[model samples]
Target: MYRVMRLIRRFEERSIELVHSGHIVGGIHPYIGQEAIAAGVCAALRDDDIITSTHRGHGHVLAKGADPIRMLAELTGRSTGLNGGRGGSMHAADFGKGIYGANGIVGAGGAIATGAAWARRNDGSDVVTVSFFGDGAVNQGVLLETFNLAALWRLPVLFVCENNGYATTLTVAQAVAGSITARAEAFGIPSVSVDGTDARAVYAAAQAAAARGRAGMGPSFIECTAYRFDAHHTWEHKARVRYRSDDEVAAGRSRDPLDVLGLADEVRDRVDAEIEALLAEAVAFALDSPAPDPAGALDHLYATGLRTRDGNGLLDSAVR
Candidate 1:
């Protein structure tokens, strides 16, 4: 678990550098301080189980065993991306590894995961599904509807909410009207709140939730209270948003997740060295990969392989 968090931490740091260097276009929702939630929740899930993620989801994907090289490529919009360069950062996915996708919509992944859980239950597969969302997502109607359905149908879905104190520039207290746990309780779904900064606490809570789900106890919700040590998006570097105070940012940074895991100094040093080596290879792989051709832009638009005529009524030239 310590190693997992360490990897995610380094990955986020490197990704931020890529964003600034123009390697990753369209910027990214940095998950710099919320690595523990993903690492802990994924550690509790089986390899065959499924998970849906949110905009700040690179950490979740990496934690769920996604190849860092492919993830970085996806962020870079290279053909080597998980979606073949179509989905990019907010939509990277590998269904073969049970990662549905990192949805751009605030609360959309809840329903998707619920549907997957329902299908898996009907198929008689014990594979459970997990959904990771931000605190702001609790107010979304889709998530509330999903909670009701998952509870009513007794689906094995675990909803993990990373309540990192802010939703973009809005604070949780300012945006959320009712208690998060109350929302789940309204639909008869069991729920709990845990320390989002502590990886062990999250891991234990998620483990119990997954256990109950597999035992046919229906879905569970966990609200993790955490704080982001970095800006919400790379654009902040240019726009200079002042929603958070300098003191607040300093305090948040002090509670580093990597330090909370209590990894031995020797272990930490070794992990850092290994991750540096891994990232060097990932960067090379992403840069050397060929970009997708314009003519094949819609290659995977549909599962049936049906092609639509271009708006100009002519085949678009292939990308050189």
Candidate 2:
């Protein structure tokens, strides 16, 4: 678990550098301070289980066993990307590994995951699914609706909310009325709130939830209270949003998740060094990867090997 947390930390740091260097266009929502939640929840899932993620989701994808090189390629929009360069940073997906997708829409993954779990159960598979979302998603109607369905059908889905204090510029207090857990409770879904900064606590909570879901118990929800130590988006470097005070930022940085892992200084240093090396290799692979050709943009839009008409309105007989 410690190693996985370290991997996510280094991956985010390297990804931030890539964004600044213009290697990753459209920028990214850095998961710098929220590594613990991804690491912990993924640790509790079986390899065959599924997960859906949000815009701030690179950490979740990485923690779920996505290859770093391919993830970096995806962010760089290379042909070797997880989505074949079609879905960049906010839309990477590795269905082979049970990662449904990293959705750009906030809170939409919950319903998608619920449906996936329901389908799997109907197919006689006991694979559970997890949906990772931000605090802002708590207000989304689809998420609430999915909660009701999951509870009613007793679907094997886990909802993990990474409550990082603010949703873009909006604070949780301003955006969310009433409590997050209470919403889950309304549907009779057992929910728990834990410190998002503590990786172990999240792992324990997720483990228990996964156990219950696998045992045919209904869905579960976890509200992980955490703080983002960086800007909400890389564009903040130019936009300069002043929603948070300097003191608050300083205080949040004080509780670094890496430091809280409780490993000895020597062990932590070794782990950091190893992760740095791995990130360097990942970046090199991403840089050397080929970009997808524009002519083949719709290659994987369909799974049946069928091709759609080109946007230029050229019929099969027009060229001949």
Candidate 3:
């Protein structure tokens, strides 16, 4: 878990460099401080267990066993990307690993997770699904509705909220009304709140939730009170947006999740070297990959394999 958190931190740092170099076109939501949350929750899940991610999702993707090289390629819009480069940073998906998708819309993953878990249950599979969202999602109607449906059907969905005290620039105190966990409890789903910076705490909580889900219990919720050490997005650095005080930021940074594990010098050094080499290769692979051709742009617009037609009732391929 410590190694995973460190990898996510370094990955986000490298991703920022790529954004500035124009290799990755768009600015990304840096998952710096929230690395422990993804690392911890995923540690309790099986390889086949499904998960849905939010816009700040690079950590989630990497934690769920995605190849960093291919993920970086996707962010760079390469044809060999995880989603053929169409999904990019906000929508990367890998069905084979049960990663439903990383959604750009706030609170959208909850419904997707519910549907996936219920579908798997009907198919006679005991596969569990996790929906990761931020505190901002507590107010979304769709998420609340998902909680209800998940509880009613006893769907094996785990709701993990990374409450980093802010929704973009707005603090959680300013955005959320009542208790975040209370919203899920209203749906009769068991919920717990834990310190997000402590990866082991989150792992223990998620393990209990997974056990309950596997035993035919309904959905569970975990509210992790964490802090975002960097800007909400890479663009914020350029925008120079400042909402929290320096003292508050310092207090939040006091408990560094990467340092919390207290790994020995030898093990930590080994992990650091391994991650550095891996990321170096990932960067090279993404930069060397070519962009997809525009001629077949609409090729995968349909999942049913139906091709779109051009003018005169002919296929677009005719022009190519």
- Which candidate's lDDT is highest? 3
Task: Tell me how many residue pairs clash in candidate 2.
Answer: 0
Kindly list the per-residue Cα lDDT of model 2 for residues 33-94, writing each as its tens digit. Answer: 88889988999999999999999889889999999888999999998988877888888889
**CA deviation > 4 Å runs, candidate 3:** 311-320
State residue 38's C-alpha deviation in candidate 3, in Å: 0.5
- List the global CA lDDT of all models: 0.90, 0.90, 0.91
TM-score of each: 0.96, 0.96, 0.96
Clash counts per candidate, in order, are 0, 0, 0
For candidate 2, the per-residue lDDT at 87 reads 80
lDDT at 163 for candidate 3? Answer: 97
Q: Any residue pairs clashing in model 2, and if so which?
A: none
Off by over 4 Å in 1: 310-320
TM-score of 3: 0.96
| lDDT tens digits by residue: candidate 1, 213-261 | 9999999999988889888988999999899999999998899888888
